[model samples]
Target: MIVTWAFGHLLGLKMPEEIDKNWQTWQMETLPMIPKQIGIKPLPKTGQQLKAIKQLAHRKDVKEFVIATDAGREGELVARWILEWIHFNKPVKRLWISSQTNKAIKEGFKHLKPATQYDALYESALARSKADWLVGLNISRALTVKYEDSLNAGRVQTPTLSFVRQQEKQMDKFRPQTYYRIELEIEGQKALRVQNNPYEIKDQQEAQNLIEQMKQHSGTVVELSEKTKTENAPLPYDLTEIQRTANQRYNFSAKKTLSLVQSLYETHKVVTYPRTDSKYLTNDMKKTMKERLQAVANFAPEVKEYIKAGATVKQKAVFNDVKVTDHSGLIPTEQRASPAKFSNDEQKIYNMIVSRFLTLFANPHKKLQQKATVAFANERFVFTQNKVIEPGWKPSEDTSETTVQWQKGQKVRPNFSIKKELTKPPKPLNESTLLEKMEKFDLGTPATRAEIIEKLIRSELMERTPNGLQVSPKGKQLLDLVNPSLVTPDLTKKWEDELEAIAQGKFSSNKFLKQIEQDTKQLINEVKQSQKKYQDFSLTQKECPKCGSFLREKNTRDGKIYVCSNSECHYHRRKDPKVSNHRCPQCHKKMEIIEGKNGAYFRCKFDGITEKIPNKKDQKKKMSKQEEKRLLKQYSKPEEPEEGPLSIALKEAMNKED
Candidate 1:
């Protein structure tokens, strides 16, 4: 058997112009450019690898092939596309396995399934690719051309931006409400408020009346209850869950976390695949649990404690075959990894996986809970406290201490106080909370969510702020102009559900594509008939002299730049002043470099002066012998030069100075 690999996607769907000549220009007449059939072509960068795959397929000795890419939807598409492109009619088998450990590979080869079994997965992937092409191209062009500015709209990116804008709108319309709560103190223990369900009073007078009635009143402990509470150990880490935790704990962006975890998987070979959505391990993996634990014992010393305690018992919560999908949850491999070999970021991700995997074998956290209720007049005040009985899996759990003894019907004097509380608005969406929202709404798959969020930030529709994510002015305007259905998550989520259904063989890919085509036409019509106008929020005050169009300003690390807003006009220039080594004669400071119709020159903005940049070739050229001799004869003999008109003028000037 021969083993080969591809660089992610070796072939991509053909561009609009490559598919049809009519869609070459960005005109409204070609709006909603949907091809009757979408075709795949080889990507430029992987041409050599693709050629090699083709040659290997045609070799006489190679009779059968095995597709051992990632065992997921996208992976199926990758191998299938390559095989179809090469016109290979040989028998094909699939090596589907979750983890890449040596044992798993050996087992996968023994049970390789026919590649035809994954046809539904390939069909689903193909349908999604075509839908995105049709919708993304048609809508992006329509918006950009109609607005005369660079605008981007997409099925997933547009809705993701809308989530930010929706959150911003909620914050803008929020009103703060003031309320009062009554608190009591007894024997130095703060008494809680239980008379009001939420312990809040909207009326200040009502609060004052209650305080006047209860002032100087004696309280009795009417009820006392104590019970034991146990919290189950948390399940192992999924990609989204770890991303959320990393974001909150380390302030790492979702993309950064994914990149780090991917490195740990691909480069370090310590963690399993990082793109899994399941949180449970397959039952068959239970046999390898001890070895996996022993592999991380060096890096995470605590794993040894769990192993000694026999904590690796397979609980139904952590090990179940039904919950696992194409890949199991991310976990540590059986290969031992040295901590010193990993980068700081890689170490962080690797530790997270090892830590979460260990938790599966830990005991349930146990705590003692006590609640005491005291009554002053008709109002009841309650106090609750929890003490950790056993730290269990979470050794870092905070333990609350209590020593006071209380009996039912005991009398005591209580101090009452009124506190004012104000309701605050929701905070802006950070990456941590944003991932949670995306997962909750099914906006994108675990593997694709990071990319979708990055696309929004890269396109400038959303920006990262110190507080959280905020919608740009362009993003807000996009929400107002796009078809209303495209702005909400429901529509896209429905399509995602259908795609999953297609993968399950319960839905038809052709039907889904036809629906997408109809939807594309309606979206295009809405964009065309809208009376709303689009304003270029990034436009600068400067205008293009050649095209008479406004110049759009963009910030870069080097400096700022101004580009012509007109799509047809190719005009752009740097806005920052270029400081040169040449010094200004008046200011004696470095001069600004400027290129003009005349040539390169140095300009001093403060002194309002300009100097031509001298050519080094002219200055360094050697003078001929004839030219040197002529100059020497003209100036060496003053008596011969005084007779000449030019020499007489120079002598007159010298006599006047004397």
Candidate 2:
């Protein structure tokens, strides 16, 4: 028997606080927009985690150390990296499981994979860490120092930034040409198209001309076809889909949602493996679905209700043996969660995963899409409508927040009433779609997608303009200066394909590492040798009023600020509008500093007004009398006779007054 103790991921490294004093400083941000780099910082409490891991290793009864993280590349990385850092040298096994119930964990342990089976996975994972360190840190620091601002950069972020930047360029070049579309009302109801599709008039003038012609002509009914099409149930929630739906519903950033979901997975133990790419479960899981459902009766009332009613689980969409890869899609387990264990966001994510899983074995949400064409005079129009005939697996009760508490709800069916027609093109990529694209490109996986999105935004290499995430001027410029491949998501796709080959033992890890090394060498040379034109928009010269010398305005954490280039010259002023710090009367804490075109000013960061401090000379004069009084008072007191120089100054000032 292996002396195995299960604990969370915090056991292997330095506490996030001890790792940097700036951890708390950076935490002051409203969001996780940490500037600098995008790689694993290995969270706080790492040392404690290592102690736990080592403690397990030291146990005499433990025969084999099994690395049982979430089942994926990231999972492998988490456990192996922890082991490596902690000097755990023992025969290791991989305890593979999806949902962490007693049964699932036991089953997983019983069928533990040979440690050697995932050497490729571990290699790829380590390579990713090292690569991110090399590229993300260098590029991030270069940008931050060059700009004198804490700008973020990363392997994934640069490509994401490029996406936003490209969108911006397209928008700038866009000419919003007016286009016209026509809709016809038949009797009281609006008609779209019968068989032929609705028409879009590309030219407004042509559309007007056609409208004029249609007004005179009498259009015959060209064709009318009405058939029901079924919209199958949505596939189960994978990490990507979960992030996507979370973004759509909650407006949470991709990274934020991922964090929430990760917490739900690791903390709540109610949700399945979150970092999976697959949305389908394995064939074997179908047998244990009942047990899994029974296990989650506390957190997921729906599961209990369905089970009590003896409703069978539906299988086609959510679970397919063929679709299951390294891991299956996310699902709930029997690890009972108290309501206290979850935050609001965690509960929401948990609900989503559980609902999708329950719905999968239950039924398909079936609706009949009916299309009809209504013609007015000679002008033809098309009309379409939907009628949900059967909510197969998707009982209305399951969809409703209030449960029906039964497998089958009332016999009510879906009815459709649709009118009006408008021609609209496919919408451009939103965050969710962009993240979906990321999955395809392999720029980042499900775990890294949100992190990349956020990293790009923090760097200002990308921006979320009114339209969407687009690359910024800085991002594009950096892409031009740096190695093209590293800055592009395309490299990830290529590497992932190769890594996949390696995982299957098709390609050698050594060969892959060699290629990465060669590529990195080439990239380094290109960055070093290139004489690219670098520009700082802030460095635009502004003449200083005090010394009649040009002062360089640099962007700082407090925004743009002017500082004299000559180190000896002590001229400095705020560039971006910012109020200065003043001690608040109530809290006695330093106030916020604000800068504007006029100059820097202080305002109490606390909820109160602040007294202003004037120029250096004025401030010195005001403080001089007070400082002298303090010196005199100190000398008069016999507290310390060691008050030598200050006492002499006090005596001289006192004698002059006398």
Candidate 3:
């Protein structure tokens, strides 16, 4: 079988500028430039791959082909687009496998389905991409033209920005109200008063009067209750859950964790697909569960005991086919991996997956919970305590405590005091909480959420702070200016639902495209009529030499640039060292071309080495053919092997063989 691959997507929908001259310039008159015919073009980076695929597809010997890309919507698009672009007429089959394990791949190949089976999936993927292009491009251009500033709007990202901005607005308008509570201490043990609205006395005088009255009477333990509760082991890691756990435990960003897990899957072949949305495996996969468990136990010996004790007790909770979709849960494959072979980040992610898998087999955690109520002056106070009965799956999370025990009808005098407290605002969005909110709102899919967040940060629309993500002034302004529908999560939910329907063949792609076109036009019209204004916060006193406009400092993922604030002028200059194609002589890695006051030189960021390249006027002349030949010969001469103990032994063995 011929194995060929497209670099993700070899073709993309044509941009507005490519469609017509009128759409080339951002103008209100060109608002909502819906293409008469959506066309595809080869992406610059995928040119070689496209050429190779075309060459292979047209080969006379190659009578058939198999599509073995990812088994998801976007993955289907990546394969189908190339075939469409090449107009391939071969009999095509589909290889739909979720995990990268050899066994899974073999099974998928054995039961190859006809390419027609996934036609609806391809349509759904195409519809989603075209809709985004039409909506995001049109609205972004309209906003940039209307505000006279470079701004971006998207179907998924704008709504996410609104989430942050909404939280900030709520915080800004929040009023901290002071309230009072009474805490009674009996024999150095504290208990809080139990009320319908616990300790929320708004008036200080009333709170003081209640405290004084409570002090006048002795306390009695009115009730004591105790019970044992069991907490089931947590479900396996979906991409989102694992990302949040990695962030909380190792401070790894969601994007970083995703990258690490993807590497573990694609490079090491030690884990299943990393972009899966499901957290449960199919029932059929239960047959291999013991092998997978053994592989994990080999790496994490702490789980071996459970595996030895029979780890199939909770199969119902973990292996339900109904809960699985495009892919099964994130899991370790049967391939045994040496932790030493992985990088530190990779090791952390791998270990987390192994630990979570092991926890699924372990027993449920059991705890004894206690509650006590005390009465004084007709007021009741409650105390709570917990003690661990069993350290089950997750011993690290056990938070058992010991407290002074009290029985029913126990009486004692206690000191009473009123404590003041204030209401607090909602916490800012951390990567974990933000991801949770995105999942709840269906803002983006598991595969795209991290990229969406990174885009917002790259655009300087949001800033990552020590506490959490804070909305930038620009992000808030963008949220204020955009149409409410574009900034509400409901739009994304609607589109996502329609996309799923299209995938199921219940909805038509053409109908979805028509709706998107109408929405795009409405969004543009809203932008053209809105009276919102935007200020360039990055503008500086420096003037652009080409445009005679104020220069604005822009920070990009790669580096920084200074560009004219005038959107029309579009003058830009690099403020950071430019990455060069030249390789370093020492490290053989790409070097950066640094321009200093002295001259231009290539510097290796990895090794802190610098080499000066001669100016055109002072460059050395080329050597003659005879001189080149001599130099080449001198450099290519082979040296004799050094006589060491190991080398001598190897020479003696070779001589003996001769």
Candidate 4:
């Protein structure tokens, strides 16, 4: 069997200009430049991969092929498109598995499914890619032309920006209000007075009256209750959950966590697929659970102990075929882990996955929950306490507290006091919370959400602040100028629902594409007709030398640049003076090297100092120790030499040293 791979996508939908030259220039007349025939073009970088696949497919010995790319919708597109482009006539089969364990691979090869089984999935993937192309390219071109600035809009990205903008609006509109709460200490146990709205006593006078009454009267324990509860071990890590946990624990961004986990999967070979959306495993995988446990025992001895203690899989909680799709939860593969061989980030993420996997087989956590209600002056107060009965899967925290035992009809004196507090505004969406929101709204899949967040930051539409992600001025303006539908997550939700239906064979791709086409046209028309105007906030006083257009400041990953505002001109220049590794003699800091008409010189920004660099030919040179000693000896000699052969030899030596 021949093995080959495509460099991501070998073929992509043709650009507007590739279809017709008239559409090349962005103009209102070419507002909705929809292709008459949506043709596929070979990507510039994939020619070699495509050629190799074609050569191998044409071999007489190769009768049939198998698609063994990632087990997801995008993976389906990555392989199917190559075959379509090459017109490979060989019958194809599909290899689908979750974990990269040898056992899973063997089982997958033993039961490879026909490629026809995933035809609907390919259609869904194609529909999504084309829809994004139709909407994103058209709308982005329209906005850039209408606004006269380089702006972008997309089905998923816009909605995500809208989420941040919505949060900002909420924060701006929030008004803080002061409220009072009464804390009562009864029989050395703390409890808070309960009301219709627990701590929101708006009237200060009413709060004072309640506090005075509670201080004077003795309270009685009117009701007491206790119950034992069991909390089963949490399900294993899905990509989103692990990303969230990593962000919360280590402040690792969603993109960073994804990168680390992906490295553990593809590079370290210690973890399963990192892009899976499911949190449950298939029932068929249960037989090899102990073996998988044994593989990771060295990394987690506690888990090994649990397994040795007869820990068994919870069938109902963990093993469910219906809940799994494409791939199972993120897990440790049967490959033995070498913690020292991985980077710190990889080790942290790997440990997280292993911890979750170990917890799945451990016992459930048990706790004793207690509640007491106290009554005084017709006011009800409630207190709750929890004690761990068994620290099952996870390590238990100490919850023991000294409290007076209370019973029904018991009397006790209580001291009460009131504290005033102000309402707090809603917190900004951090990467973790934003990811959760995206997951809830189906804005993007697990694999794409990190990229979406990164795209927003790269576009300067959102920025990372100490508190969380904040909308930039440019982002706010873009939101105001774009159509409302594009900014709302509902559009993405609708598309995702339809795509899932197509994947499940309940909906047709052609119908979905028709709807997308219609929507794209409407969105473009809205942009063309909108009354909103966008001010180029990045515009600078400097003008481009080539185009004589105003230069606008733009930021790149490397540094900032000033570029011509006119898209066609595309004139760009560095904004900051280039720094060189050559150190300054005075301050010893790296000096900024500037080139001029005359020559190159070094300038220091810290001390406001400048120094000239010597010409290479005239620069001072160091002499060797032997040459220095010889020169010193020659200089130390007397002016007159003795009239002898030895004196003559000494004179010659001195001349040579000179």
lDDT of 4: 0.85
lDDT of 2 by residue, 495-580 (tens): 77877786777887667666655665555555445666766444556777777667776545667668775544789977644544
Query: How well is each residue in 519-554 modelled by candidate 4, as lDDT tens digits?
Result: 988999898889997888899889899978899998
Residue-pair clashes per prediction, in order, are 0, 46, 0, 0
lDDT of 3 by residue, 536-634 (tens): 678889988887889989887668899888776878878878998767889989898987789789999999899887565554474545779999999
lDDT for every model? 0.85, 0.63, 0.85, 0.85
User: Whose lDDT is higher: candidate 2's or candidate 3's?
Assistant: 3
lDDT of 1 by residue, 427-517 (tens): 9999988888888888888888999998887777888899999998988888888888888888889889999999999999999999999
Sort every candidate by lDDT, greatest first: 3, 4, 1, 2
Q: How many residue pairs in model 2 have overlapping backbones?
A: 46
Estimate the Cα RMSD of every predicted model relative to the unseen true structure. 14.8, 16.4, 6.6, 10.1
Candidate 2 runs further than 4 Å off: 1-62, 82-89, 130-155, 192-218, 292-305, 374-379, 393-430, 463-473, 538-658
Per-prediction TM-score: 0.86, 0.69, 0.86, 0.89
Judging by TM-score against the true structure, name the best candidate.
4
The weakest ten consecutive residues by lDDT in model 3 span 616-625
Ten residues in sequence with the least summed lDDT for candidate 2: 403-412
